[model samples]
Each structure stands twice: as C-alpha cells, then as structure tokens.
Target: MTLLAPGSAQVVAGNRRVGMMALRIAGAVVLLVAVAALVGLLWRPFAFWAAFNPTLLGVLRWTLIGLAVGWAFLFMDAWRLGQPLSLQQNQRLAVVGINGVLCLSVAGALIFGAHVVGVQRDFTIAMSSDGAASAAEDGRYNVLLVGGDAGKGRWGLRTDSMTVASIDEETGRTVLISLPRNMTNFPFAEGSVMDKAWPQGYNCGYPDCELNSVNTWVGENRELFKGVEDPGMNATISAVEGITGLKINYWAMVNLEGFKGLVDAVGGVRLNVRQPIPVGLPNEKTFHYIDPGTRTLNGHDTLWFARAREGSDDYSRMARQKCVMNAMLHQVSPKTMLTNFTEIASASSDMVSTNVPSSEFGRFIDLALKARGQKVSTVSLVPPAVDTSDPDIDKIQEMIQKGIDQAEGTAKAAPKKKKPAGQSGMTGGSLGSLSEGYVANQADDLGAAC
Candidate 1:
C-alpha cells in the first residue's frame, strides 16, 4: 500500500498525522513533475536546455539521492506497520526479503539514473568551456570542422581537412562546404590579419603556403596574435571564412587518430562500401582492404575507410570522409546515445576540442537532432570545380553561396541527381572517379549521393 500510495500504510495504522503530511508532500511533487513534463513535451527546446544546464543537473543529482533515502525509509515504515513480529517465522523471513528487494531496486534505479546525469554534466563541461554564447549569423550557424594531425616536427597540428557545416537556424537545413587543403593563392577576409600579412592572397610563391599551412604559419608566428586563446585555430578560421565567405559561429578541431575511438564507442557505423578500401598505408606489407557491401565497420577499419589514399587521390578521400560523416550523423540515434552514454561521452570529450560554449550546448544538440530529419547538402572546392593549385577565389565563394542558397530554398540546384545506379568509374570506396568528381562531394541530397 505504501509502495503505491507512499503513505497509505501509515494512514491506516498508528501514524495518521505523519501519513497526512507525507501524502500531501507526495501529491505536490507529482503535480510539479507533471507540469514540468508537460511543458517539456510542448516546448522541446526547454527540455533540451534543462537537460544540459549544469545547475539543474546538480539539483537533480542531489534530489535523486534524497528520494532514494526517503523512498527506502517509507518502504521500511510500511513493513513495520504490517507488524512482522506478529507473523510466523517463515512469513516474517519472506516479508523481510520482499521489503529489502523493493527498497534496493527502487533506490538503485534512481541512483543509477542520477549517476548517468552526472556523467552528462561532466562531459558538457569538458567539451564546452570556451568563450561566450554566439547567436545565429544571418539566420544560420556556420561551424568550421578541422581534421588535423600532430606530428613530431610540426608546431601543433596541421589543418589538413577543413569543412564548414553551415546550418539554418530556423529550419536546421545544413550545407557542408568543404575546402581542399591544397587550394592555393586564396585571399583572407577583408582587413583580417592574414589578409594584412598577404594582401593579394596567401601566395608566398607558386607552390608556397597551401591552405593547411596557415595553421603551421600561425603556430610559428604566435606573437602576431598575442592575446588570442588559440592562434592556429584563429588563423585557420580566418582563412576558411575568407575562402567560403561564410561567417563562422564556432569551430571544432578533431584529431584523426582519435576518431576511431568515437566510432568504436558507438558500436561502429554502417556504410555501403562501394569498393574494397585499404586499411593501411601503401608501403606497409600488412595492408588489407575492407571489402565491398553494406556493413558495420569497427573503429580501425572505419578510420582507414575515411582516410585511405592508397589507390585514391585527396579529392576521392574527401568524398569518402564526407560519407563517413553523414553515416555517423544518421546512424548514431538518441537510443544509441542513451545505451552507450559513458563510452560515447568519454571518447568524444577526448577526441574533440571545440569553442562552442556550455550555454549553447542545448541549442546545438537540438539543431543536430533537427538536422537528422532534413536532407543534407554539400559543396566541395576540388578539381573541375576550381583549380586547387591556383583556385579562383570568386568562383569558390559563389559555389559555397549557391549550395547554401539551394539548401535554404532561395535558389534551385543545377539538377536532381538520381541515386547513382552503379556509376561507371566508382573505385576507392567513393561513388565517382577523382577526375569526374565524387557525387557525395557536391550533392543536393547527400543521402542519395552516398
């Protein structure tokens, strides 16, 4: 009776006053919880906001601890009210056993939930402790994604792979604008440090200073950006902003070597392998290939599948990387997140360093969830579209703008690309040849492109 009504046992026995107070408190708690849930259901952003709020999380943790103690006490009180001393020895033993199980199970479940909530708080703090909250820039949030490597000779990390995930603030429509690292002779944003340093463009010479080298250059000349928190990233962002003509809201730097841990954490990602993908560098005798077909790839193989360049060029590899990004976004559902909470949090916190603040954590998560339901689009600055050796800056900006405009319904895409029914020259796990350009690299609907 007490388990169901919280105070019924006491009310029917020797503690009517205590029972009335307990029942009143329980009723109030139920009303409060019901109202909160109803509001959350009606306004989902509020729910996400509440879930990610550190202050609320701390309160929730302590509240659960309190509830566990109080609930166990109530169960024990109910058992005492049953007058177990008056029962036979066997009956008493059975009652005690049943009561103990109820106390433990109910309290244990609440405690565990509280622990999970704490983990989320910790993960958010570690991942989102940089700078101030940024609002949507001209109805969108432009985030720069940099995949880099830190080696012995390099200053910090080389910004080898750069992509801008431009998301619509209202509708969550996203367009991925990818810039090739080899792109040269590009100008920086007007009046920016890079632009001031190299007024004409980032053209030290015919082969000098490719896009990725900007980070290394910034690292070497830290005195130029004396007060900046991260000079390398700031420089790279300036370059990307210059290249894409998009106002970047924030940025995330991902270590490629650490990416496998995230894939493993989510139990790997499922992808349609168009061809056999090499797992090691060409020089290694131990190199093997991930075979063709639709399947889930473990961490090591998934990393190789995305980064492999054994038989492929940089452009083809970029398309494969885009496919990997799309797969991970769609495959890792909220259910997967809940089930593998700790592992994913642990892996992600270690893998990514972002300037996205804690205040906007809920908003970005909500946006990501919204993004999953929409058709993703992409545009890349690779060969045939623009010459990387001496890219036409005006053309590159126009391509990015067109992609974003098409995604926003402000402009029409060139043509509806039919799902590739086995393209003629698909190899190296990408949907098209390097010379022709991969379908996934520049698509109106990335799902069909992949």
Candidate 2:
C-alpha cells in the first residue's frame, strides 16, 4: 500500500485546470475563425445578407456572450479558492487547511486507481473486536498493520513490530496474526517457499535485511527504493500482501515518534501492567529497566514500554503492542483528538504515512457508530499451544486460513449473547448459539491467536 502525500492533489488539480484552459483557448480560436468567415461573407450586403437569417451576426454574438459567462464563472471559482485568510488565521495554517481539503478530494478519486493497482493507505480499522468486517459477505478483509519507522531521524522513533489483522464484518469476527520478527523464513519477497525467503544471517546487516531489526530495515530500504519503480514501502506492502493471500484494503503506517505526542495529547494512558518489566536503551550490556503492573505512563515512557524487548521474547512484546493498541483505542475519543488537534498534527507531521483514502474515514466511522454498543474480543496467535517447530510453513498458513473461514461463518449467523462471568476467555466460551459446527473444529485451530 502506498500513500501519496496530501500535496499530490494540488498537482493533479492544477494539471486538470490547465487542461481545461487549453481546451477553452482552442474553442475560442475556432470561434474567431468562424466570425472572420462570417464577416467576409456579409461584407457583400447586396447579396441577400440577412435574407435567410440574421447574417450570422446573431450566432456569433451569442457565442461570445456564452464565452464571457463561462469565463466569469471560472473566475469566480478561482476567487472562491483564493478566499482571503481570516485576520486571525496564520498564513501557514490557512495554506495547510486549504490544501488539506483539496488533497482529500483528490484522494477520493485515487481510490479507484488504488483498488485496481493494489495501492492504498487508509485501512478500515475494526474498532470493536467482534470483528464484524471479517464476517462480511464481501470476503474477509485482511490488513497488514505495519508500524513503519520512516521518520527516525526526523522524529526519533522506530517501528516496533508488524502485526496482521483480519476482520470478517458479516460475523463480527477478527483474528490477529502476529509474526515474530526473528521467526526465520518469516516470508519475504524473494522466494516461493517460506524457508527460501529467510535471510542468510539473523541480524542481516543491523535491520535492512533482518527479520527483527526495525530501524535498519525501514531506513535502508526507503533510501534504496528512492529511485526504483514502485519501490520503498510498496515493497513491504507487497511482501505482506503475498504472505497473507488477502488484498490489503487499507494500511495505516504509523510513525513511532508521533505516538508519544499523541499519547501525551490524549492526557496520557492508563495500563494495568501484569508485572514489572525492565525498560532502557538497547545495548549488549546493562540495558534500561521498567517495572510493570498498573501504571499510567507518560509519552516517553510509553514509547519505552511499547518498544522494549530486552528481557522478554518477541511474543511477549507482541502482547504489549496489543495492550498499547487497546489503550490508544480506549482513549481515542473525538473530544481528545479535537482538543489536541494541533499537538497531534504536529506530532504526526513526519512520524506517519499511509495510503488510505480520506474518503473511507466515513465508512469506518459509520461502521464504528453501528457497533458502538457491542462487545469486542482481542486475540493473539501465541496461546493454546502453537507448534512453531513444524517444518511445514504451509500447514500454519492453511490453519489460519481455515480458522478465518469458520470465524466468518460464525459472525454471519448471529451475535453471541454476552456470556456470564468466567466465560469470556477461550475455553468453554459460548459459540454465540448460532451454529455449533463453526466452533467445534475451528476453536482448536484458532489456538490462542483467535
């Protein structure tokens, strides 16, 4: 998925206006020629000039009048676009505001092109976990949630991890596919088989080619693809798209740096840490330490919390990412965003980039509004005994595929009644009473990742 910058709209709209102007100029030239011919023909007044008609003068008169009217309207449109900035409006703010609206309009048209070419930035985020999107008849939409560290130098942050989220809207079911960065042969673009895609060395030059290195990969590849066709982030999108065998409807590439600002703007977030975890800078010796369990973290600490992986393995960190996601969602109230608009926007200036069209924001808003009162379930892939040692990578993929299929079926049947206490977690969880077959063989397959 590729997200063109908002300024791209100005370029497109400018080109379109230029094209229209050229056409109008051509039309004017044609009219002038006709007028010249008519004047010559009418010069011989003795030869029944106005006998059959108004000597062609009337037609020419009307054409010029119409042209004037059209130009007047075009001028008015330009004036409207150039509406004077308010006295209180800073020049920068006015420029950004006008261009933002224009960019959104252009992005709307870009949606069609994106669909055809498999490029997009905005993704439909299922706010509620009943994952209704996955159950939709339109085929479950699987999205790759990539936290790209594009603005490391500009904003001083790096993408922590990559997680795949699939939603079946029809059945309100969702499954999170978490891929450990170091899980060798985690599937890149080079080979047909997963094993064939693994890097020769795990660290792979400190990130660019490594499975787990976050900072190196984004920065290096972005530079590498600067001149290549469909290069840079699109390569990452393609690799993930191939891995999941699902069209990436939308993608939101969040900048890690802005996350802290966003969190701070939202007045910080509260999380119940299960246990104290050490937090610190990354190094081979004496790393930082962070104690966990029920703590309200500030912006910087929040970054440390989410990015820390010194002591625990990737799986635990995946859970931490989910926790951060949940916290952000819980606090992502319109009031919060509105209050911190400037701060949030400033933080996001270079921190995030996405290909999602601004148009789809409404669709997601509508869906969220509908599911506002429903229950949400969050699941990870690591629980219920995952067989990571299995040599057959296809088996794991197929298992996930099957679970997705069954989950879709279940979501479509009916909303499962809220189970009583002690029934929410995986085991003995109510299958929503819609159908038993959907849950029987599938629950086991879903493992703890459902």
Return the top candidate by lDDT.
1
Q: Model 2, stretches more than 4 Å misplaced?
A: 1-137, 150-159, 169-174, 186-230, 281-293, 368-391, 402-450
Q: lDDT at 12 for candidate 1?
A: 91
lDDT of 1 by residue, 1-450 (tens): 767777777899858987887788778878988998999999988888888788888888888887788778888988988899999999999999999998899889989988988998888888886588878888999999988774443433577699999999888888988999888888888888888888888988654589988877887677888788878888888888888888889999887777888999999999888888888876888778888999799988998888888778898889988988899988899999989999998988877889998888878888899999888999999987889878888888888888888999899779754545555767577777766788889899888878
Top candidate when judged by TM-score against the true structure: 1
Q: For model 2, how does the per-residue alpha-carbon lDDT over 1-450 read when each residue is reduced to its tens digit?
A: 002221122234444554356455646656877886687566633222322123243454454445444433333344344554543568757655654565444444444333322211111111112112222225555556767554534321333566665665543345556654543333444432222334332223423443334334445545544554334345455445444455666555676766787788678877655545555656636555545456788777777676665544555556566656656655567687656655665565434555543433344444443333332333333323343322134655665675565454443323444445654232211122222121222232232221
Instruction: Give the range where candidate 1 is weakest over 10 consecutive residues by summed lDDT.
Output: 149-158
Q: Give the lowest summed-lDDT range of ten residues in model 2.
A: 119-128
Residue-level lDDT for 298 in candidate 1: 90
| Sequence-dependent TM-score of model 1 | 0.92
